[model samples]
Target: MTRASYVRRTSEIEHYFDRTALAAWKRLTGDQPVSGIRATVRQGREAMRQTLAGWLPRDLTGWRILDAGCGSGVLSLELMARGADVVGIDLSAQMVSFARQRAAELQTQRSVPTAGRVDFRSGDMLDPRLGRFDAVVAMDVLIHYAPEDARSVLEQFAERTRRGLLFTLAPSSHLLRAMLMIGKVFPRSDRAPAIYPTDPEQLAGQLVAQQHMSGWRVGRSQRISVGFYTSQAVEVVRS
Candidate 1:
């Protein structure tokens, strides 16, 4: 697809989630498991969470976090529980609404000592109006964008972060690329955004190893598997 069309389609993905927020929540938190595709998506969600959380700070007391693609507040909840003030952003109004609801539920259902000032906003991360934070987290979001767009997001997050930036991607590989191409045959009724695996090295170069960002270092997280896709994340730390 052309770059502009890809971006438009990527942004338009929120429409799919507006209709499938429940299913998206399943893929975000894996709180409930149904058979077939739902089960598989839940499994993937759990795996990704486990892998991503393993690399995060165990105690985020008083830290301010920006959850760039906070789908349904999955990671935002975790960060809040770890004692971080979190700002979660997503493109889908439904997803952001669900995330807000989940954040509220988290407060009432338990003593939310660490659930500090959690806020959910419906906006694209590429918006120039966004502000900086102690750390930024964008998990499994870049899979919907082309390489250029993915790189731009990385740079933008890096520029805004004060301490670190953590993110995951569906990494491109020879076999995986071919697999994605083949999967296009089975049409999906959900009309989800096309998943485009990105290159880890490209992300690292822009966010970590670039001369312009000379103070940053790279920390790779464990790979996460979701059957239809694979994820690899990195924590870009300011050295």
Candidate 2:
């Protein structure tokens, strides 16, 4: 994607999550009651999270992971439980703050010892200053970006990633395309950012063709669908 387009889209996402839908997102990620559609989304997201986590080593002691675009820090807490020192970064400062608060509450309520630590930050997930990691889990983060931009984002992560990378995308399909078109007809105030669907095969081919990603190859993949939520997980690992 062009630099200008990326910047504009990023700003839109920040605004949506930080101001437009903050309360709704909190309820969706929390145990609070939500509408039937959102409930299905919540279930789908949990399943996707588990799918991504299952790709990593069971015992993550001494492993450093990045929860890129970690909304509400659920995945970060899960990684910490597995003994991975995690850094959860999100574009929305409000989301990051909520994540911090949620993490603390869970820690207090559970009274469990976590072998790893989590540092939640509000910033761009592609920021290099966050440092390298053994694995990077970017659940549902790339689904909004155009395919090319999504691939470019992954290339940046590959530069800093040591062993593996896990992320999700909205797979291309006629039904999903129709859904996107239908969503656009909704009132502006009632809409979320537009989701861009991608073909997994094409994306994998692009990754393999990139010279910078020569050492990395696409690995396992899975798709999860529940009500209004559908996402595909793809893994890239060192050769």
Candidate 3:
């Protein structure tokens, strides 16, 4: 494999986390505002929320949910508030810090003054330290690896999941590719170097090959004036 395809180290992801957090916070709160990044964050958040809404149960009480590569813990925090036991892991230390801080802020804002049911960890998705989760969601991630490595990562995700999986990828259409290209050219985008453009079909095939799921269902929503598609896959495992 080329050096570009090598898995990015935690330090690299941490730097990424630091960059995106500043942008996301500025966009979300708008107290410290950037018109451009705010637009990007709004789009991304909408895409992520649409993806999460597709796979998540109407109520997740007492369920175990894992957010892999969970930057800023957006879905993780939401699931915890719904009474799921949530665990968020990221290779980026900065992301873990941001998630923890966000969780704290959320706890303070609630009328019940309750804490979130989330545990944040700094670790690679491939590491065994993560144990297992009932459902795992990794959004806007996995595109950083080469196609082969991406398949391996999906296999790893399958091993850890007891119920379902949800994830996002760049859309397969030519229009969507052009849109992503334009977005990448935006100032300070900090795009992942090895991000090979892969669509839901390719990813679904990979998961099926690993027996992670019998098949995958594709869905999408628009964000940031772009189309973001999600792949939802389910595997039946015998107890």
lDDT of 1 at 155: 74
Q: lDDT by residue for model 2 over 11-80, one digit each (tens)? A: 9899899999999999999999888899999999999999999999989999999999998999999899
lDDT of 1 by residue, 124-156 (tens): 776657677888888878777767777667777
How many angstroms is residue 210 displaced in model 2 relative to the true structure, after the best TM-score fit? 1.3
- Where is model 3 more than 4 Å wrong at Cα? 1-6, 9-11, 19-32, 111-116, 173-194, 211-239
Which 10 residues in a row give candidate 3 its minimum summed lDDT? 230-239
Residue 142 in candidate 3, Cα distance off native in Å: 1.3
| Candidates 1 and 2, the one with greater TM-score | 2
Q: What is the TM-score of each candidate against the true structure?
A: 0.84, 0.95, 0.73
Better of 1 and 3 by lDDT: 1
- lDDT, candidate 3, 1-239, per-residue tens: 33344454344555665665556553463234445655555566665665565557767786887788876777777777677788888877766777788777767887322333788987776677778787777766665555566666666776777776666554445764576577677564455432446655656655665544554333333322332333223222223
Q: What is the C-alpha lDDT of each candidate?
A: 0.74, 0.90, 0.61
| Candidate 2 runs further than 4 Å off | 184-190
